[model samples]
Every structure is written in C-alpha cells, then in structure tokens.
Target chain A: MAVAHAANDYRLGAQAVADGVYVFSGRNEHFTRDNGGNIVNTGFIVGTDAVIVIDTGPSLQYGEQQRKAIAAITRVPVRQVYVTHQHPDHYLGDAAYADASIAALPATISAIQTQGNALADNLYRLVGGWMAGTQSQSPTSTATPGVVEIGGRKLRLIGTAGHTAGDLMVYDEASRTLFAGDLVFHDRAPTTPNADLLQWLNALDQIRQIDFKVLVPGHGAVVRDASAIEQTRDYLQWLSTSLHTAAEQGRDMVEVMNQPLPERFQKLAVHDEEYRRSVSHLYPAIELTTLPRR
Target chain B: MSRARAALLVCALWCAGSLPAHAATAVDTPVDPLNSPSWQYMRQRFLGKDPMVFDARVQVQMPSAAEDQMQVPVHVSAPGLTDVVDVLVFADLNPLPKILRYQPTSAAPDIGFRFKVEQSTPVRAAMRTRDGVWHVGGAWLRASGGGCTAPSVGTGQGFWQDRLGEISARLWPQQPGLERLRLRMIHPMDTGLAAGIPVFHIDRIDMRASDGRLLASLQTYEPVSENPVISVDLQHSGPVRIDAHDIQGNRFAATVTP
Candidate 1:
C-alpha cells in the first residue's frame, strides 16, 4: 500500500505492485519544469534493513521529492541508489541523496565526469528553469555487474551498453521486476542518440531470456509482459535496416529521414522527432563507413 | 519643366541601353514565410528597390540543410558565356552575409566555395553580366548557429598550433579560358560554444591581382569550417595574391600563377 504523503511537496503516486517494491512512473513527455523533471521511472525496494532506490529522476528537485515519497512509505534506511545510465534523466537526481552510496557502471561514471557538464547544459537548454539548481553529480560508487546484496535482499545488476555506453538493468528475485534503465522505453519511443543498434538487439534478447514478471522502463509505463521488449527490439531492427539499406543505395540523409515509418511503430510517442534524430545521428557515420578511404 | 524634360530624355536613353535584348525571366515562388524574410532583406540590401528574376544561367548547388553549420559546401557554375563579368555569393542569414565576390580574371566559368552559416537562409549566387543585369540563383539551407562561438572539434589540447598559419592556394584552367582558383589555409574556426575555447576563425580575405589591385574581397565569420578552402572562378592569373586573417589578427598570404 502507498501511504499517503504531502500532496504538494511529493505528488508522485507510488504504486506498489509486489510485496515491497514501489515505483513512481513519470509522464510520457519531454522533460519540463511543470513535470518537475520526473521523466523517468524511479523504484524503491524495501529490504529487511534498508531501501534500494533504482534510477533517481532527472534533477535534485525530483530526487528530493522521490526521497520524501519513499520516506513516507517506509522508515528503512535508503542504503544505496543505483543509477541506470549516464543520461541526465536517470542520474542527475543523485544530488538530492548526496549522503547515500550512489553507484553506477564505471563507463557511466566516466561519461558523467567528461561529458556530464555538457549534458547538464543541454538539459537546461531543452527544458526551461525547472532545473534551476540541478547539476550532474559524480556517482560515489561503481556497482560492478554482479549480484548486489543489500539488507538481505538479493538484486542482480546486469550491465549492457545498448541505448548508451553504460546502460544498466536490475532484477529483484523477490518481486521479479526488472528495472530496464534506458534499454527499454516501453510504449514510448526509444531515444538512440548514443545507440549501438546491433548491441541493443542483443541486449533485448538478453532481457527476453531473463525471468521477470514486471518490466519498469526508464522512459515509459511499466510492462507486465515481455511483449514491450519485443516491440522495442523490432522497432530498432526495422529503423536500422531501413537506414542501412538507404545508405547502401546512395540515398542522402534528407531522403533517408523522409522514408515512411514502419506501420507497426506509427503510433509511438515522439515517433517523428526520434526518427529524425536517429537518422541524423547514425546516417553520417554510416555514410562515412561506406565511403572510399582517403 | 525644361529640367524635367531633360531628365526624362536621359532616363529613356538609359533604359534603352540597359534593357536586355532577349530577357528570359526566371520565375520561382518565394521560399516559405519564416525563411523568405531573410532572402528578401538580402535582395533589398543588394538589389535595392528592384529585384532581378532568377535564371538557371547561373546555377547554385548547396545543401538544403547543412549537417555541419561550419564548412558548408557551395558550388556555382555557368556554361561558357562571354557576358559573365563576376559572381557574388552570400548567405542571407549569416552574420556576415556577403561571403564572396568572384571577379574572374582569366574568364572563369566554374566556382566552388564553402563558408559558415548561422541559421536557415538562402545561399545565393548573383552573376553580374556585361549588360550590368544580375542573374540570381540560390538554394535554401538550415543551420543551428553557434559556428562562430563553438570550439573546433579537431583543435582540442593545442593541436591547432601545429597547423596554424599554413596556407595552400592553387589555380588551374578548367579547359581554356575558364579557370578554378582554390585558396586554403590552416586555421580552426572556433565558434566559442565549448567552455574555455574562445572564438577563433579567419574573418577576412582579399584577393588581389599581380598589381595588388583588388579583384575580390569578403568578410567571413565562424561556422566556416576549420581550414577554410575557397574555390572560385578566375580569369586573370598573373601572379595573383591573397591575404587573409582570423579574428585574432593572425595574417596569412599566398600567391599562385598559372
């Protein structure tokens, strides 16, 4: 049961799906101040002696709100915060939990250190003043890919470089819910700014092989079945093949971007926007690869 | 009344001498509204109250939208024509819009140039013929500016120091009288977008004849790709010299003869 909290300070409706796992799902929209930078799924698992926060939201404001909401739900000590990836939406909020042991993949932490400030500047540019005091904070810990035990709870941390270089996924044995960071966007359109589509396909196959009843994605609504994973896989494959074929045929970027979207993915949120961005991001490199060496 | 009649007589004589013998007017609808304003302003600024109709006689080939705001490729070409005097290139929305004024020395017929752009605007080539009529041609390109204020991607960690001040310029006849002059220099047109990387770029170029008589000159800003190489049509190639400088006032010069 989600214990009621102060609506004004923490309005996130934490839904308890299993015995001790509660998730606060963000809206299927771009980061905006009105939404308070809550554009990703944040989950907290209540262990016997501590709480595990999975993927803090985008800003300190969102992280603080999530922390208060979790405190309202349980009195357990929030032991560790696992950042799913280097994307600002998933890790910038760790600033609010400065005292907590925040852990992320080694590559993810490095990215935050090198390109993190640039990403923070972009976040402010895209979304207005909602991130007034928000900034990227380096993770305090590196959670290697293995079984992490906290407060008698056994959680599996799997590392995959799919959507980004340091994409992370966490699975709970007790709840059977997989926190598939940016690897899966569920019903929403998956962003591929730093995607390796071929590896992303392999990552999806890995997710399919995992034993999980609930899939909490970083961007969209939580899924109860593996169909969402398959849908995302299909979308990635289709767009990649389409662009690859276009490149082989000597089609320019403008022509490739105007190619019709696959019928199956026509209804995806931000389909056009993401499709345009993906074409711009991948086509130039793909074209260079196809060109004759100097 | 006597003064007014004399002015009318002068105007008629001038119109008679100025009108083309056979005017094949090129008609094209204005670009989209958000974009049309810049090009319109450019034409008004250059053409004054009268805007010339476009003609394929002078064709401009440019990317519809630039992937890299800096280092945009532009090519202008026209078939062999004796009336061709010079070609002027400009980007309607660039901070310094007038990019090139190509005065063919040996009667150049082909030109290819590149520069930086700030936003979506028309990349135009206006060819002035012997009759003093401008035949316009253009292509629309969109850009996310900051080329002038962004750091050079390839110049990090003091790499630009090794190649700075190097100049490479050459010219050759495309066939006979038509020639191509390509003048390139080593410099990073840093746009100043990155933290701590200041705006560094070659901002001006003066093309002079063997006698140092100005053939063409233009003001450039960042968004012009790192290591700017400008190719233009040239007719008179008698020890032609070019002098250029960046925002920091670092001077570079080169002379080539064919």
Candidate 2:
C-alpha cells in the first residue's frame, strides 16, 4: 500500500518565523506509512549570499522535498547543513545534502557513524516504503559551540545534551530566533529513548537564559514566548519524580507502566504512548538506585 | 488364535496394566495453543513425554507487545497449585528457548522478572506439581526482534564496569503472612550472539533466610535481561540473604530486612 502511494507528497510548506528564517513544522504524530515519517520540524535560514539548513527530515524524499520548498522561497544555494542530534528522524536525510558540508557535534557525528544504520533500519520497518533509497549519512564536519559568520549571517551553535548524548541548537543573531531541537517539545509529549532527565533540565535552564524573539521547538507549533520550555521542564520533572517514587516503592515495570498519568499531561499529543515508552527506558535505572546497594 | 493375534493381545494387556489411572482421561490441549513453527520441537524437548495439561491456575502475565525487547517484563504465578516442584519458563521461537528454571522451596510459586525476547513468540511457564503433572500457561508476545543478539546499552557504554557485582534489594509485606523480596544485580548478561562480545550472565541465584534456610533458587540463562531484577513472594517476613554467581565465577551476596 505504501509503495502504491510512492509518489506521496509531503506538501511541505515553509512558515516565516523571523526575517529570512523559515520553519517547516511537522505534524504531532509518530512515524507511519501515511505520514512518511514527516513528524519532525526542520527549517532553513536565508542569508544574503547562501542558505543554511537546520536539521533534515526523515527519508531522502522528505529532504528532497524540503530542498524544493526552500528553492521556491530563495535561489540561494544551501551552503551548510546542521544536524541537531543523532536521532534518526533528525539526521537520516543527510544524504539529500550531499553537496553541502553537513555537520554536527563530534559526539553526534560518532553516534551517527556507529548507530545510524541501525536506527535507519528501524525507521524503515516503522514507515515501510517511504524509506525506499534513504541511507544514514554521517555529518561531513564537526560543529563546535560558538558563533560562526557565513554569507553575512551571524549564527551561534549551542552544544548541549540530555535529550540525547549530543544536541545542537541553532541561534540566528540578527533575527534572534532559536531553533531548539528535541530538547523542547511544546504540545507534544517528549520522547525519552535516550534521555537523561537531570541533564535535560539543566540544558533547559541554560536555554531559558538565552534572549530570543522567536522559539522554534523540534516539534509542535512555533511560539513567541518561553511557555514550551517551561512546559517541557514541568513534564520532565513530574516524570522523574514519579518514576523515582515508584522505584523506591519497589514497583515492578508493568505496574509502573500501568500507573495513571497526571490530568494535565492528558492533553498532550501521544502522551500515553510516550509515557509508557519512557517508563520502559528510565524505570530500570531508577529501580537500581532506589534500592540501596548492600 | 493365530500367533499374531496372541502377541497383540499380550501387548494390549501389558500397556493397560502399566498406564496410570489418570491416563484414562484425555489431556486437555491448550485453548490458544500458542501455535508456532518451533512449538512441537520445544514442547518435546522441554516437557518430554510427561503428563501435562494447559491449566488456567498457572498464570503467565506479559504485555501483548514488548515496548523494549531488551527488557520485557514477565510475571508467572501459580498460587492455586500447591506443592509446585519445578517451574520452567521459555520462549518457543527464541534462538535460546530456555529462559530460566525456578524452584520455590519455601516460597510461594510466584515470580516476577525481566528477560530479552528475540522475536514474536509464545512465552510459556510450565509448573510441575507434586503429582508429576506439568501445568502449562503461556502468552504470545510480539517484538521487533534482535534483543538477545544486540549488545546491552549499559555494557556498550561501560556503565557496569565499576558497579559490577553490586547488589540492591528491598523487602516488604505483600499480604497476610506473605512478604515480597525484590532484588537486582549489575551484569551485562550478553548472549554471545552479538559481535565481539563473549557469553556472560549470572547463572544462578539462591535466596535464603538470614539463618540459612533456603527459600528459593533460580537458574538463569542468557535470555535474562541485563542487570536482572527479580521479585519473589515468601511466606516469612524477615531478613533475606541472597547469594548469586555468574558464569565467569563472580560472586555477590546481600542481606535485606523488611
């Protein structure tokens, strides 16, 4: 069925979040054949002489479609592509930017090199025919944490962890717009497959100090305020505290998973599924600590 | 009578005299059967030709699909079956079929643990009562596969090096005169299927009272998840001393009080 819809068009549209900065906000859903894994946010900044792309979508087709969307807006060639993290959804489309100098943090680059293929394979199984020729491509260069001017545009690359082992956030100095990767989920439930909750909270604290006019989260709608960051922090704190309490009580994994969610998080998209997945990922480690070593 | 008819009559008489009285009744087949390509072979290999029945009293609980294949939670309990001598848990389609063998010596025949599932398979729990009848219970679990073959996250990240052999435990009252002891240890439990990693896992564990009375014993295999955590119900509400050893001769011991 997915192959029959091989010509599936993402119909991606670029929304202007700031001057010369545009974001293609994806749907708040998981990977499926119908969505073609187009459930991640990606964007590009049009500089005076060139364009800088931030994070690619899932699958080669999505990336190609994103390039086309950018082309319709500006004729500026994409000079640099920044991969935010090692998550398959963010970096699996690296193959589309073969001509550009695709880059990520050093750790992220290594993770992509080591685990990218496996992650891509998993996505293929989840979305099926959408991943026809998509291949995991490691970043061609390393992105350090500092400001770098290119094509008359000043951009700052912030290197942080917690959402993953390596997460890179892009900040445009002129427009004062911050592209926060999976580190901040707005209305959607945050995924925690490789999360370090404490580290994530610390990273959020760091992000909160930044002065930005527009905040583009990795998922969900763009916001002008810090509500997304605060919401994410609150949900993560609740999740951490609840899991700690359950582990301290010596509750089994199944019981912890079946526990009712807070009424507030019930409104989040895919909250139940993401919460169960988080339990499976974080419960074992928490349980190991709650019961003291003898 | 002819020679052939006389011989056949003698054989029938011998078979009737040797068969047990319960054998007169037909053994009930499993309602769902948990049909798999490897079912017949695995059943014959594990249960042998012994008298067995698919009993509802033996409860095997697991999620319909594994959220994490590396650590699928499974709980097997036969509270209604008294004097359960041996309990065997296995996955029919797993490359390594046997999961663990649990002996509830002085404890209730109830266990909670985690294991790795290689693929979609029927996980079965067969408890042998004192009468030599094996009561079987099972559930079909769907997984994305590659659990046992994939290297453990902790091991790959070197998180278990310094913490190896560390034991953590807790005990609490579950019901009237019954206490539950939950414990975990740090180990990789690699299945040798992964590249460059050798076979390594905790092979055996013995739970006893502080005064040296055996409560239960468990023999685990590579299919057991990393840093194995297990909960067992005991009749006594007192301190429990757990002793365990891995295939590599590493020993660990801990004592916990309710």
Residue-pair clashes, model 2: 0
TM-score of chain B of 2: 0.87
Q: Write the per-residue lDDT of candidate 2 for residues B1-258, one digit (tens) a residue.
A: 143244334433543454456454323222235556776677678887666666666777776778889899888887678999899999998989899999998888888899999999989899988877777777789898889899998888999998987898889787776888888888999999999999999999999988899989999999999989998888887899999999999999899988
Best by TM-score: 2
Question: In lDDT terms, which candidate is top?
Answer: 2
Best by DockQ: 2
What interface RMSD do all candidates show, one decimal each? Answer: 9.3, 1.5
Report the interface RMSD that candidate 2 achieves against the true structure, in angstroms. Answer: 1.5
Taking all chains together, each candidate's TM-score versus the true structure is 0.67, 0.86
**Per-residue lDDT of model 1, residues A1-294, tens digit only:** 123113223377788967799999888776665665566888999999999999887776678788888989999989899999988888888988887899999989999999889788768766655566788889998989989789888999999997988888989988898998889877777888788898899999999999899998887878899878988988899888888887555444555666789777888876876787687567655654443211
